[model samples]
Target: MQELKAALERQALAEGFAKMRVTRPDAIPEAMGRLRAFLAEGQHGQMDWMAERAHWRGDPAALWPEARAVVMLAETYTPEADPRAATLLHDRGAISVYAQGKDYHDLVKRRLKRLGRWLIEEARGRGSAAEIKVFVDTAPVMEKPLAQAAGLGWQGKHTNLLARDLGNWFFLGAIFTTLELPPDAPETSHCGRCTACLDACPTQAFPAPYQLDARRCISYLTIEHRGPVAPELRGLLGNRIYGCDDCLAACPWNKFAATARDIGYAARQGSPPLAELAALDDTAFRARFAGSPIKRIGRDRMVRNVLYAIGNSDDPTLAPAARARLADPDPAVAEAARWALARLGIAIVDNPDMPEP
Candidate 1:
């Protein structure tokens, strides 16, 4: 199994994975309890799926009874520049560094499948019947905890997996296999007293040092939550349109994280003018973000988020962008437009269309 493990690591690297380690299916003993508590407190917000699949996600062994090992891998997508700089561009909408490129689900999963197939072939050649399942973020899998269990990284105080060497910019992918493998020692948190990630959140999403309240998170508000965001938090959203990267970028470990090797992870969707984004109809939005993860959020949600960004932009020049969406078809988009207009101090008197700032 040690030889197989070595071979697997080599194959994973060849498949473009940054790091790979093996762990027992039941390695993450505390995952179920933490997940239960997080759900009990309603911290997941609109993501009811977490509660729905708690049984499987809490225990990887339970997800697949015969699985003897969880092969955790990291796929780096570190941004070439500071993502926070884009958030400061008042007229532009800031997309998270991860989403600025192709959807990682497609990218990582394809590589995982390739690696998994190689593992099966290599194991059978050694006279072992190997059964496996590969999973990205979409599956009912607690990858961060499992990654920590495999010694790939520890879950930082911000609740994302960050390696001392790999920083905070990698994606996690899992391959559960029936062939027993040597498990790596688990990694413990190195965050210590550092509050870098906690202090950088624009919406103060962190309830405490390590706990997160998704309901108040700008990433969740912009991407997950439907309808208009809470008025108080709308202004706090600033220019972030897709997802917020403040906490991740704030981590000191990022200094060691290398930029992405795969050109597909490059920033093809750099910050665009809020006016341009706000005007995207369904077809245009779909075409613009065809291979992007942003496409999943749909045109109305994107426009709704753009209007919110416009509201928080503070630049009066972006007012027309918000004003035009006041009569948008989607109730949420229209509401966001009105809020943006009001935030800019442009009174929407009798007409749904506001004059100017």
Candidate 2:
């Protein structure tokens, strides 16, 4: 078992994973209870899918009873530049580091498939049958807790997995298998008396240490919540058009984070001008964000987020971009355009002033 574990670790490292560790299927028994509490408190926001697959998400063993071991791998996407620097560029749209390049879901899944196939071939040589399944961020599986259980990292005060070595700039991939691999020691919290992440939150999304209210989270508001954003939170979003990284960037542990090995996660063309992004029509938006995770949001939703940033930008120069979208067919985009125009104090002569409903 020890020899097999060593071999698996080597294979994972060769496959471009930063860290790999194994845990039993039932290692995270407490996660389900915490998940239920979080759901009952209505903290998941518009992601109702969290409630729909509560059972499978809460218990990975339930997702696949045949799986005896869960291998959790971390792939770093740490930004070359300080992610917080983008926030200060109020006239530019700050895209989260994770979405700056090709979609990680596609990148990580391809690696997992390669590793899974290798594991199966390895097991066959040893006269053992190995059945496996791989999942990236899209699955209902509770990745953070599972990663912690595998001795990868602890869920930090910000609720993101942070390691003594790797920090919080990685994506997690899981390989569940019938082969009973030796489990590693679970990681314990290293965050002692540190509120840096909580204090750094622009929206105060953390209700308490180790708990996150996603409804108040800027990342959720920008990416998940459809239609016009709640007017109150729009100002707090700053220039972050796609996702927020305040908490992740604030972690002191990030000083030890390794540079991302995958060049695919590198920031593209720097941060694009907010005025330019706001000017994108559906076709232009699709082309610009091709192969990017940002493409999934589509033009209407992306434009709505851009309008919110333009409103908070304090640069009246972006008013023209906002005005162009005032007559957008999508009510949400038009509403956001109106809000931006109002904040910029630019009144359009042809458009009647409509108060925010």
lDDT of 2 by residue, 1-357 (tens): 677778989999999999999999899999999999999999999899999999999999999999999999999999877888988898998989899888999999999999999999998888889999999988899999999999999999999999999989999999999998999999999999999999999999999999999999999998999877778898999988988889999999999997788888877746789899888899999999999999998998999998999999999999999998887878898889888989999886665543333
Weakest lDDT window of 10 consecutive positions for candidate 1? 348-357
Q: Which pairs of residues collide in model 2? A: none
Which candidate ranks first by lDDT, i.e. highest? 2
RMSD of each: 2.3, 1.6
Residues 167-241 of candidate 1 have per-residue lDDT tens digits of 999999999999999999999999989999999998889989879999999889989998778888988988899
lDDT for predicted candidate 1 compared with the true structure? 0.91
lDDT of 1 at 316: 79
